[model samples]
Target: MNNFYKNYKGIIWLLTGILCGSVAGLALGKKIEVLKPIGDIFLNLLFTAVIPLVFFAISSAIAGLEPGKKLSRIMGVMCLVFLGTVIVAACLTMIAVWLFPVHEQLTGAILTEKVNPQPIGNQITALFTTGEFYELLSRKSMLAMIIFSVIIGFAALRSGEKGTAFTRFLHGGNEVFKQVFIIIMKLGPVGLGAYFAYQVGVFGPQLFGAYARSLGLYYATGAFYFVVIFSVYAFIAGGVKGMQKFWRNNIIPSATAVGTCSSIATIPANMDAAKKIGIPDVIANVTIPLGGTLHKDGSSISSIIKMAVVFALFGKSFNSADVVLLALAMTVLVSVVEGGIPNGGYVGELLFIAAYGFPPEALPPAMIIGTLVDPMATLLNSTGDTVAAMMIARFTEGKGWMENGEYGLESGVTE
Candidate 1:
């Protein structure tokens, strides 16, 4: 019995969640609103851990980078891989939106008067009146946190003996947060179940038709983005044989990510696969963790597509400049600036929505549809990470840090 439970824990939890979600949906149909609060509590539990967890994880990761000029190359390669993928993803999503448009006006679309949540008054007050406001915005802020962490970490490296202890402390903190992440992941099934249940309950069957249409388009666009972007990368990096081998080795991580729909939760499995594919320890260690935090191809692409669709459905046409800005902003904000945690999705999506000036009623529908389409997003994300790792591995060959045959264990590297 213990062995069975151990072997089937994830499946069991998933099935349990589906059952709970179904029940919650039915209850909502019957007009039982109490379940909504239960769902909120579950969601709150997920959200509460995000800020601290992201700060610790990213700060430690950046701080721990070997302090030297080599760090620049590492950051450069990472940024290129990230930005390149984002551009490709954005383009593909745009193509998909143009090809298979899914625009349906939502009946009863709740429209609230537009109010600027970020007022000049609040901004000034936050800057001066609150001592920790800057800290909160800087340290806990996703993009700000990454920048601050990298700067402080680099400073520590430059400080010689003076910064050694602090750097070590940060490293220790990173490890602790990793362990905490593992514990949180163990609760994933429960949290996901509650989240799904709440979604179904709150939205009810009335939302089914609209969401189903939107979500289907979302997933379709995501799949197209993955195939187009990753396939090209695979061809350039490894040719047909290399691409085949790469996919063979990474199938597990991709599947797991798709099934779980949480890139952060899939880190352990992704790292394990990276090792098997012969990705250098340093590269994998740096890339996968950083990728989980910042490499959000699926999420970013989906956001663009969803935004385009939403605008069209509302009879709003964005100029080319608007599209360009939205694409660039979504790519940077979603991929690089977002946190690498479970509920990081919510924060990232909200940030994008706000930055794009999307409506509030759109938030709920977007959240629901986005969550439903998460598995597809995760698959693309994991696949993109694997492809980037492979590309970096190929580029780093001949450099003393990495040898040619290292990542070609299964299928030897071809010229």
Candidate 2:
């Protein structure tokens, strides 16, 4: 018990802070809005660190690798696995909305801002490259940042002896930023607690009342996917034993994901969980970091919900075959499109509105529903990365991977 607490105390405190903040918000209402900056401070710290953190993490992982089929195979398998799970997520949500259906009367004033939607080609170009190197320093250009890191990593690896120092530099940088993130996260409880309070205090009524019915559908559906569907993935990864190992190590990551509401922020926790679960560092390092950028089952599920709800709100039938197929396709396309955008939440909303030709008024409720669903959506997106790692390890290392002394359950890690 003491050991469990030692391993998990960070997340415990963070969740407690969120709960307390939520209660305070419910009790104090608008008065608690004053605490918003505290939460913003925490978020800003994370956002500031993320760009460099990702660069080092991915680059160091790649630099440490040798030219082998395993790494390339892992990438191939990871892409396929991510795609498969995302589709499953979208399909499950599709069935749920179809069965119960989401019917919402848009009560809030629609967003009146002028939106000049960009062309898809331009969006994709912007997603992958920046006009200047300085632009990659920003978190908005995460995918571009990742691409550059990979190039540097491979360059370092190919340099043979000369690149060794740079490889060490990448590794040293990775460790430094990780420790920095740990320090920032120590403030998680108070920061997230205050943030939660501000959100509920300021927008709770709109989120809880006006959007409640639709929110309920998403929350309920996300819960099902997070709990039931993910468990099946774990079981498939290692059978019954895989499920036990996964659930046992997943608590901190799961809680952290919900608290942070950012997959990138949750990477460290997921990395630790991957360690205790005995995934090869090669697999964990690549999957968790890459997953934050490339993979998002939660967001995929939300894409379906957003499409359906928007169609329903506009008094259109979303039950047609073509529309459902389009929703699935759009979810995958926008998932890639928004990954590089800063504050990725809004990018997808705008992209979908533009792609489907939804009127500007449709943007408001889509934004609200998307915003409210973010916590769970992030939870799924972040924790699912760790589970995906397990599956990847199983494929790459065989079913006996866990028992091969990589996973020292008593000591957490053999290393």
The best candidate by TM-score is 1
Give one digit per residue, the lDDT tens place, for model 1 in 1-415: 6855653465566557656765776676435444555445544553455445666656666666664435444556777887888777877767666666555434433233353435545533442333543555431243444445567667776776887798788778766765665566465555555555654555455445555667777777776666666777866666675567667777788877866656776788888877776677666777787787678888777777667545553445533654566556656666664555444555565545544445433444455555566678778776678778767766655332223444422233221
Off by over 4 Å in 2: 1-70, 104-210, 405-415
**Which has the greatest lDDT?**
2
Reference-based TM-score of each model:
0.65, 0.60
TM-score of 2: 0.60
What candidate 1 gets wrong by more than 4 Å, as runs, is 1-49, 69-75, 98-105, 111-150, 168-204, 238-294, 305-327, 337-343, 353-371, 393-415
TM-score of 1: 0.65
